[model samples]
Target: MNDAHHRDADAPLRMTDAQHREMRNAQHRETQRAVSGFRGDIEGLRGLAVLLVLVFHAGVPAVSGGFVGVDVFFVISGFLITGLIVREVRTTGRLSLARFYARRARRLLPAAAVVLAAVAALTVAALPPIRWSGVAGDLAASALYAVNWRLADQAVDYMASEQASSPVQHFWSLAVEEQFYLVWPLVLLALVWWHRRTGWSLDRTLLAGLAIVALPSLVWSVSLTQVEPGRAYFVSTTRAWELAIGAALAIGAVRLSRLPRAAMVWAGWLGVFAIVVAALAYGSSTLFPGYAALLPTVGAALVIMAGLAGRGRNAAGTGGAAGYGRGVGRFLSVAPMRAVGALSYSLYLWHWPLLVAAEAAWGALSVVEGILVVSLSFVPAWLTYRLVESPVRRSGRLVAVPRRALLMGAACTAAGVAGAVVVHAAVPPPPQVTASAGSRPATQALAETSKRPTAKPPPQDEPTSITLDPLKAREDKGPIYRPQCHQDQPSAELQFCAYGDLGSDKVMVLAGDSHAAQWQPALAAIATRHGWRLETYTKSACGFFDVEVGVGEPAVPYPACTAWNAKLLQRLTGPDRPDLVVTSSDTNYQVVRGGSILDPQASRPAYVSGLRRSWQAVRAAGVPLVVIRNTPRVNIDVPDCLSAHPRDLAACAVPRERAMAMSTDDQIRAAEGLAGVDLVDLTDDVCPAPRCAPVIGTMIVWRDAHHITATYARSLAPRLDRAMAQAIGGRTSSTAE
Candidate 1:
């Protein structure tokens, strides 16, 4: 909704009767102009933007680039808000920040507050208990309009990345918009003040100010997206330029209006064409809000500029230029389009939470089911718009007094936050399960190979208790998961940690990506028991191989992984090479060959070759190598599954064959002819034979979908030790300890 035109309330006290009448007439004319100037085309654009986002989130394959719809919204917001501020400044010769912010709060906060509280209630009713605390945190962030920063931090966080998406994650865009609203007015006010002092035209000053803000943001967006795409996608800095584009268009609207009618009509259709093409062409792999965002943002600007040119009334007394009225503007001004546009904001707020809740209750939805769920959200969206948004926005009591509206906004914000706190408090704490006194250390049990039990079918009954609480299982990572030890995706720096008997002469090194890091607890236990020093060289998602690989969704080339792998190989083949090196990796890594990422199946041969090349280098240096076959991946969040099926834990188990099939035998193939290289297959222990249990023995097996819990890994120390001893041809004297 546009801001209401408010004249100075105290002006009449100082004015003569004749002057007061003149002032009232002028104010009435301005108000009438503002009301008549409402762009039906802009309303239709809002409808189109929300529709694109809805279909995109619903997983419609046809609108792969529908995400550009958000860019369109950003541009429209910039144009409308900037125009409001500039118009108020020009007419009154001053701006009231208090009134401006109060209007914004009244327009936005009520509907948002209603949605956040609804999400909290939905979390309690539909989502698994394990997800409550995380959703509560998300709710708190959304309530404060800081969820975008929260989501940005989580995007690059290894642990948080594995967690399910928050229902309020969609609030990230709202957070960005609110942040802009908070800062943009002050910026424009400062520029107007400067224009008055410097004797510069207001248009020139505003345009210069927009350029100053937008240029650097555009550069940062492009640069950051190349290196840190995950974080770049959510952060505010990368998105500010899009809003500035609209502000620039608004500032130049008068100049645009003087353009020929034919030119404006062509520009309008071209803008529509650009948006449709982007919606059809863009996909997940497209680096976003960077250079790619220019298409939609500029397109939105052109459309708005076209609307300005068409503002003149035709002979029929209908709005818009005669030529523009017959073109794209007519289609956008239809009754159905305007209705959708009117409800767009509320629809945007309601659709995502419903979709997320539905998916949480019933696995991933088919395209038809997703569309149905999104369709169902319209009921809530319309209700919220009719009952909450319209009522608060048009409240006469709040409109007359800005302070009252601000206070009401504060109360709504507090209510949303309080709801989150209550939900968080309602989550049950992790349960405690103590180990039996009779059990021997896993290292000791596996060392006595002859007495080791044969693999058996997974049990039909769920265990009454597990060693670690399933709710907190994702935090059960080994030392290698630490930020200082394992490098993140964007860095090529070589960082390693020392564990086990650090001063021992015999050195054992653990190497590879997170898959290799998952075995650190077992290896550390074995190293200490055998009096060997253990050093680890691991990176998140980076494999210890000779070939380059890809990371993130849609799989871009990971230069950091390649550089780190090269540095690691140099250390292994150098004069101070360890006595033995143990390596493992997730075989699903896509190979980056000839500047293109190969599909998983196509990448397999390249991975096998890379493994052999690296192993040969280690062997040529006279260092023995042991390859831990990649562990089984359950292909679902084990903790989430277990928490959802706590009473029937067996329901979370995956068939042994399916779980084992997750790993390719690339390591075994690589070690086939290499004399000093040995392969250890732990699939039998981790999965048993008939099925893979989410909880094996007393401990939860998998921390997430693929990685094993540190608690479970420690339990396998004895088996790892025995296997290492046999592979190396004999047990050392320290093994008997």
Candidate 2:
């Protein structure tokens, strides 16, 4: 069979079969009318993208956003893969399931299996036994093409993971591409199938239907980029529109090829310039796949189109369009680039591990060294390409010995999973990976506490705030570690609210979860001074309903936050008639398990219901509800803070640039609803000047990784005083008790 016997005859990621036929029909049309040789140029572009990805992971400063290379890969994949489908469908009348997957298995599985096997063997030897398990588990996920989700879970979490490390991290893109191949061709093929059955132009039909998908996906990509950038990056659903850009091009290349020669050349020129500029100018800060992404993807599309146009230029009195593929096209087609592109799969496989090993050996790779490491991976890639790639691809041996290779791939994947399992099993199930770069007290402290629960000291040690007897803390009343926990309530005998107690005004009830309870001391003092009664109602991880995720979590036994909030809600709405309801929870921890995220429709409605109930309860009680926004979480554990920096002013601070960025949009949205609610945006105070200093003024803001400290709560007395005054319909006073 010709190497170009054409694989990926159908798309892989979409959910239907008819769609596969449409892709084949359209691709057949391209073949019949001369689709040109831009396909090779697209492959070249893929090489450049994979190179960017390889270098970025290799730690090249120049390619900080080199991860965007994956986005580029996606776009290129969409275009070229779609073109193949179109050609197949137009020629064969039907798409072949066996051939499509067989080719993919041959192209992708061999190198991936070899890499996994090598990594597994190397990791078992090099890594401490403690870490081998996790590395193994991630390997399994990678093998199954599900590492993206696995990595995503760890990344988007509100816990202590900054994503600076994680060896299997590079597999995310491969999984994403595989995922794309799974369904996209089906959509194209289905259109063809539908057309064969309905007699419509595959071009107009696919182009129209794909547009419908593209538009909403465009919205979702931007929305997710705003709400969850990391999730947006790894999730195939969010990334499809990017690839669809390429798919649209493959379907419409005939029209582009027919355009005036000069027009095609200019389009091609504009496209090439965009790709180059994007590569050179963009970096990490850009809100990607947002508007910033259009630059590279669309540019690649135009270049591909132009290259296609160029090939067909002189063919039919079309000089430029039919002349030759050049510029980005020609450059990509050069011997060096073509070889790189051909070996790209192997190169991508080898590069990340090599770089990771190099980093482990040398701590960090300098720009020059990073480049060298990436360059070095090619040596192995070349060997693998000739040995692993060429052999499996050329000889029918791979197919003949499919079981052996399949077993090999499975065994490697299983070993990786087993390693991860062992590592994870040794630790708690929801494994937490921490990167303590420096030997600060915080890191050491975290290392101490991260061990299986042995002895936990009292709640945060400070001037005075909350305290909980670990045994009694789990009482029917719920977690009692409030700010004024150790202190008496507001009263003349108590000399008003003490240090932690701010005050309780108009019988203000602070009701919610741990976040809601953190306000007790501040509100206590303020209420005491203002002659208002302050009551606090809280649950550890529970919210107002049984749905909200708590501070300490997995939500298995159900977070105490929801239970406590529910009780408080019941109590406040009934006899208590508390004049105010102030509550908050970590809006980020939406409990999920086993690679599945809770849908917004699932628990979100409950959250909204709770909010509405709270509002209604306050309305009935004739009280105001102060709904504080969930604080942006810090990744460090509190004990780590005390142990690491002890008292260093700038020690564990979240960089000011990052601090000012603001919390999750979901938190904002959750608070935005409600009839008589007052929002207290403390995002500023939480991350103050010079940067979100580890210690704000004199108070450490966090208790553990995500909770607030009583000291920091006290420091925000002034801000809380103001927020409360507005929270309730009354005059407020501020004084540091």
- The model with the greatest lDDT is 1
How many Å off is the CA of 318 in candidate 2? 20
lDDT for 441 in candidate 1 is 34
lDDT, candidates in the order shown: 0.82, 0.60
The estimated TM-scores of all candidates read: 0.90, 0.58
Candidate with top TM-score is: 1
User: lDDT per residue, candidate 2, 30-67, as tens digits?
Assistant: 44356644355656676777777776766666656666
In model 1, the runs with Cα more than 4 Å from the true position are 1-36, 312-324, 431-461, 465-468, 731-737
TM-score of 1: 0.90
In model 2, which regions exceed 4 Å deviation?
A: 1-40, 58-62, 122-134, 312-326, 357-365, 399-737
